[model samples]
Target: MTGPDRRTVTSHLLIAGMSAMIPARSIAATRDPTARTRQGQAKGFVRNGASIFLGLPYGADTGGARRFRPPAPPLPWQGVRDATRPGQRAPQPGIGPLRGPFADYFTGNRSAEIAAMPETLGEDCLVLNVVTPAVDRARRPVLVYIHGGGFTTGTGLVGTLGDRFTVAEDVVLVTVNHRLGALGFMYLGGASPDFADGNPGMLDLVAALRWVRDNIGAFGGDPTNVTLFGESGGGIKVSLLLAMPQAQGLFRRAIIESGLYPDPIAPQVAADQTRDFMARVGASDVAALQRLPFDRFSGAGTPGNLPVADGRTLMARPWAQAPATAANVPLLLGYCKDELTLFALGQPALFDLKWPDVPSRLAAAKLGLPPEAAPGVVDAYRSVFPSDTPSDSYFRISSDASFGRAMVTLADLKSGQRPPVYFYRMDLDTQLPPGLRAMHTAELPLTIGLSPRADADTLTKQISGAWAAFARTGDPNHPGLPQWRPYRPAEREMMVFDQVSSSGPDPQAAPRAMLREAIGSGAQYNPL
Candidate 1:
């Protein structure tokens, strides 16, 4: 708990004594724990009964010419590679600890969790961390988690959550680190032949799944029973993978939590942004752009730096059509009720917003709702949560417009396919500030069994049990929780996770209808 925060670590590294930075208590040394990956042997350690492996590379270094292209396979190594500590994260814009009104909300007011954010970063960041009951061939259900940072920041290190999920659920927990921001998603096909393949960030995930398919068996995982799950940006990645051909048969199940990007950047828009980026960086040619150090422009990011609907890697936008290719994969998707509260924390005015200002504020949020229709949206939301304040209603309305509607559309699109679809909405109160009710990422720690609240153990058992059940079979329903029904248009049933979880039909009907009327489409505006 006394360890340096992310900013402090970076500051120490910036100074000359980085080599002398204090380290955490080391794990007891025992050379008996090992796993043979296809690339090479991995030397891990035993902790609380699980074999923990950290920082195993699934792809080659993506620094110079390989920056914007498809990932290459990691070369084979001769001897055991040490995986005792966390791996390097992809270079991202902000590498410091957050210090504002938003920090408490994002970190759940946990100093240890904030300090656990990995400090080391580099371009060769396509690594994964694994925690398993053992390295034997037991064929446990594999749960691969992708971290969320809005396609910009974050790494795959699972921290305490990884060990908890692995041991409690008896599953192999694998967390991955892929390219973020410009390095992973920037479209350069319109500029040169070498960068024709866009969405290298997405490609990095596909490569990781392939690695799981090939090498996970050696680490006591059932390659055929891999379940892909992520939250926020990581959730968006899980959603995008459903439509990708290369990611088709890599996994058997998918779970998306608050990760709906209704609008991926268009190819032309991505190209325009690429040109602007080149000009801003003063690089006239592709060669010059490639030569610039990653830190020089790691902070440069735009909306255009998202996944592109290029004809090849990604044929169309995710959820544009029924994922016919992934028809057999059962899906579990949902979002927090107050999804936008985390983003709203930094703004003081939002806390004191009045009823008359609701419409303008909603319109200003740019959730694709027309300005004239804002009043009707507010009225609709008021009808649902009759006692909510104007500020509370504003947050709920905007969250539904951006996240709730898209999740409904995706569930609708994936409905009636060969495989079943399950839906839910996280409504658990975080016991934080009053306005941050069931804020974004509140379900993560609880579901991963690392929540600091002593009272959350019961709900965590039910939630994490459902996830493990889904990974084991196709259904999320288990004896520990209520009977969760597959989503059907007629019933529209979804499990609502809270202090006392229950099944419900159309929890946000009024506001959903209003947003659909206003925007004419159910999907738009994904803010991470």
Candidate 2:
């Protein structure tokens, strides 16, 4: 689904990088909400009492010569542009039907959600969506979200529509779509001068943030009080953003859900991956690679879109040391209780494992543990949850190895700094199959302020309200929640979200210790 080729507009003033401030005069109310941006004016419609705008260009199309370069500013337009429909998604291989035993359960049979997904996939996907309660100068809080598909698949349209969140919390919600997969992260700096930057996907996000800083004020949002958050891959991106010099001051607060890894792709590893990808596509040079059909790049052996340590854009391991830039920015980090269950659904053998196979099954690559430590890790979890089967224990142990342990380490590292760091564990079980407790993205519906079942309304209000409160200030505490304290090494306090949410010390203490020991030093740990 290649979009129409866009002609390069003569280089105009790039308003996104400018430091000029918009005057705070009261905005006049209009019949149909409209806002004039640096590029041009856009007209949006009111939906369910919120002024909604979709598909506003934040950066120019990354097709042709712009494939692997830093994102360019969007071209100026003559007249008012319509921004009422969803935008194109980044070009990548089709993520065909969800597979495995829990496929239907994973999707929850939500046909409406399946239908709302973006239809267009192309290189011209540097667009974003905005939803605000009003077009007046109310100066509401802004929540800017980056969608998660591990930097390869997915778009802003997937789990973060954010309409309900904006209307309910009176905050402006923005979701952005940027380059993904090889097109976005392929390392070409060592190969040719034409492709010096290998981390364009990360740069695309920086460009989008610059656009938000410049243009969000006109849409009834407080540009100074923006919160940047994402789940999974998006959370990893947030972690990386904390280390980026270009992303400084673009956001005030950050929330990372189920994505906290300490290491980024080494420069040499990224270059090797790029060479391997080029060889797979039979392209020896940048021109030959660009001339091939886009699909050919994603067909087979596509390199993972992990951000690279280019020594410029990203200096070192993202979280190996506390980023000085993020020292003042408050952070919220968490993961679901059973993050690996949804992923394990595709592997039938994992579900059928018996006690004898627990150690072997837990020794998989994602565990990030020594082979000898699997037995001890399994024992630690079994001691915590006595009624567990071998498979259940495997799920919990593997999840901690991948997400929980790393988040704990990160919280510890960040707590040493002055800024507050809050940690959480989502324990809401999916009733679809009953035992799938807080699988990977189970917190999305509630966090994004979507309507939940009758039983979940209170929980939704608690979670979503807390998120809004955090964005409004740096604290996640509100009347709906108990006195939530910042994470500290002595107590390791954390919020647990469920049908009834609560705050306490580490819930699974033994397993956390076991996994931490298995992975050796936290600074050198890598889990993606």
Give the TM-scores of the predictions, in the order they appear: 0.90, 0.88
Error of 2 at 15 (Å): 32
lDDT of each residue in 234-319, candidate 2, tens digit only: 88888889888899999999998887574667878888887887777788898887787766656457775577777778776767
Q: Candidate 1, which ten residues in sequence have the lowest lDDT sum?
A: 13-22
Query: What stretches of model 1 exceed 4 Å from their correct place?
Result: 1-32, 98-117, 301-304
Off by over 4 Å in 2: 1-32, 96-117, 364-366, 433-435, 522-528
State each model's CA lDDT, in order: 0.76, 0.73
Cα deviation of 369, candidate 1, in Å: 2.5
Clashing pairs in 2: none
Query: How many collisions between residues are there in candidate 2?
Result: 0
| Candidate No. with top TM-score | 1
